[model samples]
Target: LWWCPTGLLTLLPLHAAGYPDPADTPAGRTVLDRVVSSYTPTLRALARARKADAPATADRRLLAVSLPEPPPGGVALSPLPGARAEAAFFERAMPGSHTLRVGDAATHATVTADLRTHAYAHFACHGSQDVNDPSTGALYLWDKPLTVLDVAELDLAHAELAYLSACHTAVGGATLPDEAIHLAAALQLAGYRHVIATLWTVGDRTAVDVATSVYTSLVDGAGLDLADTAHVLHRTVRALRDADPRDPTRWAPYIHSGA
Candidate 1:
């Protein structure tokens, strides 16, 4: 299912909606159990993503950015100790095909430059959504924040998947309710064929587990197959849901966007 939600509907986790209790529905009631869901800002956006050429096999490099600690002289945000684990998983999974940038190395400039060169990008950090102005929403880095506007301005021709392990990446501004102007949408606008984002704040430990499972299923001896991304995420989330059937919070926030 390719969802193109407008206004407040964009803020909800439609893919996870349905009866949470297994006893209520024998075959499982969630949208996730029924189909592999992905979001797009519009039908035209989906069409454009589908029309774009796939990234070359040789160019399937991964850029993994990890910001476990907050930047110096800034608003004191809680540290994400699990980001390091997530970064390490990417290194182990991709090995020679990955660039691991952590701590002071994950600067806005470096990440932006790396995005242009890498076919796949993964950000494990703090994400802030400016509810007043969604375009100002950003993924916190070393030097500064990589704003939605910053991402939307870029033209990443080789871009494939961008797994945003940070929080509220898919949440749009309440002020501009109809506008699809969040970090996830911005990445799609920047030319990423697919994006994995969260609808709200997610636990650091949970993020690590989800990333590990999702990537494990997606990665092969050669490299990641972008075609399997949505289904892989669906399966991963279903497993998570099965582990704790009552707590949708543990599994539902993670969403896939674009092609």
Candidate 2:
């Protein structure tokens, strides 16, 4: 586990830090190369997510959203070319997974309503971070931003996992170092048992590929287990880091933020 000792640390990806020397042996040199990691805003929040394990069954549902449109009055966001691939991965890897593709149908209300019905969720879209008001940080939808406060208001007992493939989903306010007022923590507060989120803005292509690899590993022939997810991400990120030893940004932003 990585510790965020200050507000600045909350904005950085501590888990992604690499070896002090390039020539150093790859074995156990980085967090990703060693243990399965889970991020928690606090020890209490971590305990809540681990209280119950996700049930393994064919009926397990995943709600995937891909928002390719720019929001009203918001800065224009280039459509995520990787969103389709990310959505397709969930559909193929998880049984009974459903997708809300980028289109007229994938509205905010629609996605919010679907959240209540699904056990897992994947959001492939733009994220807005309000540095002054961390609770206002949001994940963009077709109609509006799904703010952190909106997520906290939810009572989703059935929700088990959430993959936030967006920018700075785990970033919190500089003013509130201990509160953890960010999208990743908000989702956990809302009831997700495990959450895969990014610590900063991520590359479009790498995000899709890494997200796919993580899910594929978790849902291997045996089936998906929530406890195994952290290791799955660790292995996948390590592989990405191995492919390019110099670029920690490519593999380091992603983190498992719950049980």
Candidate 3:
């Protein structure tokens, strides 16, 4: 079982703890480099937007944090949402003094604290699915993991944006009969204005790069509308792979925005 690196660390390795030498491996380096480039500007734009939106005297700020490693190849990574990108993505995406909360599942208390306090949240992990059964849809964590039902229970009010970098969190269109099993739709109805999710089983590696970059763009208003966000991400990932339409999986499957 091999797990990939993504999330904030997808942009910065040094700032990210628990993870190995992400830049040391060829695949790791390529992902890190792409995420760093895509999110650098997005981060700046987000800070500017946040600053203007903040009320005078409000101490609103940005905070990016992550665990150590990705899921071990064949094993589940704790069944909670966790991002694996570079930490720089956060440092740059949200400028100004930021809080850093680093810990494994052993420190579930740490992750819980940050989620309750942070304004932005990013979760990149293995998202389980069975379009026929969303109750089964869950985010895999490296250590401490809260189930999807648990996520539904937690009041994610302070958090403005949640990037669900997982696979098939939203893929229950014609397949299911009763109700669609779309994570984004469910989250939005739950009061989340911006919810970034996948429409199908995206390549873990490709999802790592595409989601990190797109989320960055959305943060900066490059594609505020969910529809635009989905299009830009689909096109960007395909462009990276050279637009090989012959290979559907290479340039297809991954879709988002409006269900």
- Which candidate gets the maximum TM-score versus the true structure? 1
If candidate 2 were superposed on the true structure by all CA atoms, what would the RMSD be? Answer: 2.4
Write one digit per residue (lDDT tens) for candidate 2, span 1-259: 6453456777776776556545754456665655666788877778888896565564366788886556556678887878877877766776454555564566778888888887778898888787788888999887788899889889888788899999989888878653499899999888888888987889989988888888876674434556688878888887897788688778888888877
Write down the lDDT that model 2 would get. 0.78
TM-score, one value per model: 0.95, 0.90, 0.56
Model 3: residues with Cα > 4 Å off, grouped in runs: 1-84, 92-113, 157-159, 173-178, 219-242
Ranking by lDDT: 1, 2, 3
What digit string (tens of lDDT, one per residue) describes model 3 on residues 1-259? Answer: 0112233222122211122234345433333223311121123333332333321223234344454355445454543322434344555665554554433441445655665665555555556665445555655554544344555555554344456666666544333242333455444433343455654566656655665667556554321233344346645654654444245454344433322
Which structure is stronger by lDDT: 1 or 2? 1
Model 2 regions lying over 4 Å from their true place: 2-6, 24-27, 53-59, 71-73, 99-101, 177-179, 220-223
What lDDT does the true structure give each of the candidates? 0.88, 0.78, 0.45
RMSD of each: 1.5, 2.4, 13.2
**Model 2: which ten-residue window has the lowest total lDDT?**
95-104
* Residue lDDT tens for model 1, 1-259: 9998877788899998876654655755668778889899878878878888988888788999998888877778998999999988877777798998999999889999999988899999999897778888999999999998898789998788999999999998785453698999989988988999999999999999999999998887656887878888999998998888778888999999888
lDDT of 1: 0.88
